[model samples]
Target: MSEIIRRDPRAEWIARNRLHPLHAALQSQNQTVWIGPNGIVRKNPHAIAAGFIGPAGIKRIDRSGAQQGTGTRRSASVEVQLPLHVVEQPAYYVAVVPDMVGGRLSSHDKDLLGLARRLAGSEGAVLAVVFGEHKESAFDSAGVDRLLLLDGEQYQGYAPEQRVLALRAVDNQFAPRHWLLPDSRTGGGELGRRLAASLGERPATRVWQAEGERCVGRAGAGQQDIQRPLARLILAAAECAEPVSETRHEARPVELAWQVARNLPRIEDLGPVAVDPAQIPMAEAEFILSGGNGVKDWELFHRAASALGATEGASRVAVDDGHMPRSRQVGATGTWVTARVYLAVGISGAIQHLQGIGACDKVVAVNLDPGCDMIKRADLSVIGDSSAILQALIERVAAWRQEGRRDAA
Candidate 1:
C-alpha cells in the first residue's frame, strides 16, 4: 500500500498570512511556541504537559505516536465568519461606480469602495451602482452598504451615453453626496467624465488619496500631485485606499424610482473585434501569461497563452534574449501592467518586475525554485518545471473548452 500525504494550500496560505482572520486560530492550533504581539515569546503549558518521563532521566514527547500505536490526525480548520456591519437608515449616500471588468470587481474597484466606505463613515451609506450582469457575490465583504444593479441589454456592451443617462436618473432619485468611480481606461474613467459633464460637476480626476474635505491626485504625466478640496464627483486611481478586509457591510438592495431615458448613441459598438493576444497592450490586458529566462519552451508557452486566451508578456531577461519582442516586456523599464491575474512562468522576480506587477490583483507563479522572490510575492505558487506546468495547463484548458462545447451541444 502507498502512503498518501495531502497538502492544504488554504491552511498554508492562512498560516503564512498573519493579517488573515483565521491566522491566529490556525497558528494557535498548530504550534506550542510563538511570538506575542508585544515581541515576547509565549509558550503553551498544555503542549508542554503532553510530555512524559522516559526510561532515562530525560522527558520525551511522542510526536509520531509510535508507543500509542496510532498517529493523531490534525483537526479540520473551522471557517471564521466576519461580523456584519449594518446601516438601517443612512443620512447620505456616497455612490461608487466600479469598473466591473470580466463581470467581477477588480482591485481598483475594491480600492474605490474602501474610499467610499471611509467617506460614508457610519452616517452615510456606500452605494455600489453596478451596470450589466456581474459575477461578483462578495459585495458585503467589499464594503458595500447598498447595491443598485442596472441590468438590461441596453446597459450591456460599450454604451457610455446610455450609462450616463442611468447615472443621471440615479442622481435625481438618490441625490448621493459624492460620486466615486475608478479612474482607469476600462470604461470607468470615460463614464465618470460623461457623468460629471451631465451633472455639471467638476470632477477630481486621477485621485489617489481622499480624506475629509481634501483630495490628492496626480497632475499631467504623473510627475506632480494636485491637492484640492474634495469635489462632488471623484475619479480615483488604483490603490486610492486599502480594500475592506476587517469588517463586512449590510449590502442592502436599492432600486431606481423611475426608468432611465435612452438616446441614440453616436458611437456604435459593432460588437467586439478579434485581436491577437500579442497585440493587446499589457496594461489593458485583464489576464497575462508571462514568461522568464527559465522558460525553455517558447512555442509551448505561446500555445498555452493562446489556449488560455491570455495576453503574452516576458521578463526583461526573456526580452533581452530575443525570445520575445521589446513591447511584450513587462517591468518598470518596460510596460507596467495592471492585469487582474498575472501568471508568471519561471520568473525569478526582479525588483523592477515586481514593481511593474504591483498593481496586479492576483499573481500566480510557476517555478522550479521554491525560494525565488516571485514565489514569495505570488498569491499562489507551484514549484515545478515550467515546461511541464505549461503543458498541463494547456491540456486542462483544452479539456475545459471541450466540456463546455459538449454541454452546449
Candidate 2:
C-alpha cells in the first residue's frame, strides 16, 4: 500500500529457515540492524568486535604486587554497541525458503547473480534466501543484506491473513523497496501478503520483471494497489511462476476465489462482500474439559464432552479406537492448545503428548492409577476409574448449568 516495489525475480534472496544464509552473507559485507523510527541502517559494532569476559579476581600475592579488580575492557577494545548501516543504502531482495518435505539443495552464485540482477534491477539490490531454519549464514554472514524471520507465536500455518501479518513485520523492520519470496507452497506467501497490507496495498499475484523501482505485474487485484500493473507492484511470490498459472510462459497472476484470498480487493460487479462468520471456539469459558485415550469409552467421552460444553480431543490411544476425529487429536503429533482450564480423563501422560498440549492455565487429571504421569502433572489429581469420574462430573455439571440458568433468569 505504501509504495509497491515489484519482485526482481532474478535478484531475490532466500532465507532458509532458522538460519538465513543469504542474510548472513549480506551481513558479512554490510552489517546493520534496522531501527524502525530512524528509517536508517545504523552500524552494529558488537557483531564485528570480539567477545568479552567480566572482571577477574584480585591475586593476593607479593607485597609489591597489589592486584585488585580487573577491568574487562582491553586497551584496543571497541565500544559495546554494534555498528549500524544506513537504511536503503544497498537494496536487498528476498527468496522465500520455507521448510520443505525433502532433501537439501542450493543454487550457484551465477544463478543467484542472475536472479539478483533480474529482480533487483537496481545496482545495489542483491539476492538473499528466506526460510524458517537451517540458514546460519543469512543471519551471521554477509551475502544477504536483510534476514526476514516469518515465524512468530501467533503463527500456526500460512493459511489465510496470517501470511500478511508475517510480511508486514519484516517490511516494518526494514523498508525494502524490493522483497522477493519463492513461488513454493512452503515459501513465505503469508509474510508477503502481510507486508502488502501494511503499505495499505494488496499484492500482485504474478510478476515478471522490475524495471528500476517500478514492478511490472500481471493485471488483477494489483491494479487497485498500484498506479499501473506495469508500474510498482506487491506480491506473495509462491513459485518460480504463479500457482494459478498452468503454463510458465503464459503465466498470469494467481487469482484466488474471494473466499480463499481474504486479502483480495473488492470491486463492483464482483458481487457484494460477505463477512465471514466468527469462529466460535465451542464455549465462552476459557476452561476446557478434554477427552483423551484414557476416557476408555467413546459414548462416555462424547456424552461428558457435550455436558461440559467442551470439544473432544484425543491422545494416541483414543484415536485408534475411533473415539475422536483426526482434527480433535492432541499430542506431539497432534494439536497444540493453551486453554485456561484443562481436564484430562483417563490419560496417562506421555512426554510426547504432554509436549503437545501442556501449555494450559490449569490442568486437572482424574485417573485410576495414582502413579500415572498425568496425575503428577495435573494441578488437581482425582484418582478413580475414568467412567466413574465422568459419571460424577456430569451430575455436577448438570446442576451447575441449571443454577446458572436460574441465576440468569
Candidate 3:
C-alpha cells in the first residue's frame, strides 16, 4: 500500500521565514512579536495578517533598506489578498478531538461531536480522535462514525505540544477538511490555534453558531462573523444545549503510529495540592453559590457559601476585580457549570455570564435590579441588597441549626 503524502503550508512558511524574529520567537517559545517588512512593529503578525494584510504577501524593503518609489507616499489602507498557494481541496471527513474534563468526556466534548456530525452532513464521515485512557464503548455510543484512539504514556499528560504532535500526525495521513476542537482553556483551544498556525489554515475561534461554512460569534460586544472555506479549521466555543440521544453506530477503530516528541517544550505539572474542595470550582458540583459585582462583602459571600456547603463561583466582573481567582469564574470565558442549583448573588447577569450556567436546573438570582437579565431568567428572584439578604439567610440557617440541636438535646 502506498502512503499518501500531503504538504503542510504553515510548516513551509515557518521554514522559509526561519531567520525572521517571529519565527525565532516561535522556536524559543517566547511571546510572538512581528516586525513588518516595512519595519513597522506589531504585537502579533497573525492578527495583523488576518485583519489587515497577509505576512507573506507583504512587500519588503530592498537589501539597501530603500523604498521602491521615489518619495511617493504609500497607501494608507491595504487590501488583504488570500494566499493562492495554500489552498487545498476539502477532504471527505470532519475530524473532532474531544477535550477531557475531570478525566472524562465533558458536555463540551459531546457538543463538539454533535457539531461535527451536523457539519459532516450525509456524505462526509465524522472522525473522532480520542486521547488518553477512555472507554471505547462510550465513544461507540456517541454519534461518531469512526474513532481513532491514540493511547500511550506520552499521551497521558495534558501537554499542548504532545497533543498538537498527535493531531498533526493524524492530519498528515487523513487530510481532514474541518478540524473541530473545544474552545476551552485546558482543552483544545490553544492546541487548535497552534495547529491552524502550523497547518497554514484560517482558525475560527469562539464560534457560537455554524451556518454551513460560516461561524458566528462576538468580538468584544460587537457581532462578528467568520466565513470558513471548505478546507479551513474551526475551534467552536461549544454552546450546544440539546441532549445527544443514544445512537447505536458501528465505530471503526483506527490504529495510528505514535512517536514521542523530542525537543518540545513540556508543560510542568504542579502536582496536586491539598485544599478544601468547596474552595475550588467543581465541574460536577450539584449546588453552586456564585457572587457578582453587587455583593459588597467578599468575606460574607465566602462565609455564606461555606455555610451552605455550596461550591463557590464568580462572575467575570468579580474575577477581573481580583475578588476571586479565574478558576472559580463562571461565564462564557470561564468554567461552564451544569449544577442542579445556581445561586447568583449580586450578579447583573451579562449574556456571557448566563451562557456559563445554561445547563443549570434552576437559577436563583439575588440582585437589587429587578429587571436584570439574570433576574428574568432566574427561577427565584430576590430583589434586595445582596449583602443584607445573604447575611439574613446565613443567620436564619444558623438559627435553624441551633434550634434543631437544642430540640435534639
Candidate 4:
C-alpha cells in the first residue's frame, strides 16, 4: 500500500491547492498516495428475465399436467435506451473485471461511463478496470486501448487483503492523481481507509455526478429520506466553473467508458454513492446469510443456495476453501452482514464467526446435530444432512413451478 508521508511539521508554509491535493496524503504527513479504481456498472433499462441464474430471461417449465416442458414463455421486459459507450477525459477511471460471478460492461458500468462522457472536463480523467481471474484478459484478447486491468494475485479469487496491496502498488507506480476502487463491500472500505491512512489524509469518500447536490449522511437506527432535485450522485465538485451544453465535446464520455464499466447506467446522473462503512460508525445491514462449514464444494453449497433466493454468503471457511469469493466471506476480519434472516449452514458457529454476523434478525440452522450450539441460537433447526435438505428444497421449488403452471392453465 502507498504510504502518504505526512506534512513535515517543520514546514512553515503550505499551498491552498494542497487542500485537495492531486493525490491522497496521510493525515499530518507529506506523503501523498493515489487511491481509486472505482468499479462501475449500469442499470438494465430494458426488459429482463425473472428467476434462475441465466442471461436475460429464464425459461419456465411449461406443464401439461405431467412433469414435462412446454414451449411457452414469460412476458417480462424493461424499457431501455439504445446502449452507447462514451469516454471521459482525465477523470480517474479504472476498469475492473468481474470473475465468473461478474461480467464485462454490465448495465451499471454503462451508466457510469455515460456519466463520465457527459459530465467530465477534458483531460481530467483516468481509466482502470478490474478483470476477474481470466486466462486471457481483455487487454490481451482485444485491441481495445485505455483499459487498465488489475490482475494481481487476488484477481483469481476475492482476496480483499491482496487486492488492497495491489491497489497500493498501482497508486505508487501509476501516480494517477485520483484512484477509483470498487464501492462494494467492507473490504473495499477497509482498503480505502487503510490506503487513506497510509497517505496521511482523511480520504474523500463517495464522489458525485454533478456539483451543488450535497450528500448528507445520518447515523442512527431510524428511517429517513434525503431526496434529490436532480438525478445524480450528490456531494460533487464541478471542475467546470460554468454550465455547458450537453453536446459540448468537452463533456460526455459515457459511450467509451461502457466497455470497461458494464454495470453503469445510461444516464449522466446517479444516486448518492455510499461512504465507506469502515470510515464511520454505522449500523450494518439488517439481514445476512452466514455460510459456515456446511458449505462443501462451491457447487453443492451455492447450488443449494440457488434453490433459495436469499443472498448466498460465506464464512471465512468458504473463502479459505476457495469455495466462495472473498467478497462474500463473513467473519471478524471480514464483512459484517446483518440481515433479518440469517442461515448458518455447516458453520461451527464459532464465536469469531458469530461475532461477524450475529446481529441477524432470525437464525436458521441446518446441521447434523440438532443439539449444536448454533442450533440453539437458531429460531428454526432441521436435524438432518444439510445436503439432503438442499436437494429436497430444490425438489420442492420444482414442484411449486409445476403447480404454478397448472394454475395458470
The top-ranked prediction according to lDDT is 1
- Output the lDDT of residue 82, model 1: 61
* Candidate 1 backbone collisions, by pair: none
Output the TM-score of candidate 3: 0.48
Model 1 alpha-carbon drift over 4 Å, by segment: 1-79, 316-322, 325-336, 348-358, 368-385, 392-409
Q: Write the per-residue lDDT of candidate 1 for residues 83-179, one digit (tens) a residue.
A: 6888888899999999999889988999999999999997999999999899999999899999999999888888999999999999888899999
Tens-digit lDDT string for candidate 3 (1-409): 7544555668648645633324534443232365544567756333322233223234332334243234432331664332221112334778988876554566678788777777866567778888887743556445677778877766666566777888888888777878988877765888898888888887877776787656665466546555454336888775642324434444567666656464355577565665564855557676899999998999999999877878999999999999998889998899888877899999988878888898886799999987677887799999999889989989998999999999999
Please give the range of 10 consecutive residues that has the lowest summed lDDT in model 1. 69-78
Listed in order, each prediction's TM-score against the native is 0.73, 0.33, 0.48, 0.32
Name the candidate, 1 or 3, with the larger lDDT value.
1
Q: Give the winner by lDDT: 2 or 4.
A: 2
Q: Rank the candidates by lDDT, best first.
A: 1, 3, 2, 4
Top TM-score model: 1
Task: Report, for every candidate in turn, its global Cα lDDT versus the true structure.
Answer: 0.87, 0.47, 0.71, 0.45
For candidate 4, write residues 231-292 as lDDT tens digits: 22212221212221122121121222222212222234344475432332223443344566
Error of 3 at 324 (Å): 16
Residue 21, candidate 1: alpha-carbon lDDT = 47
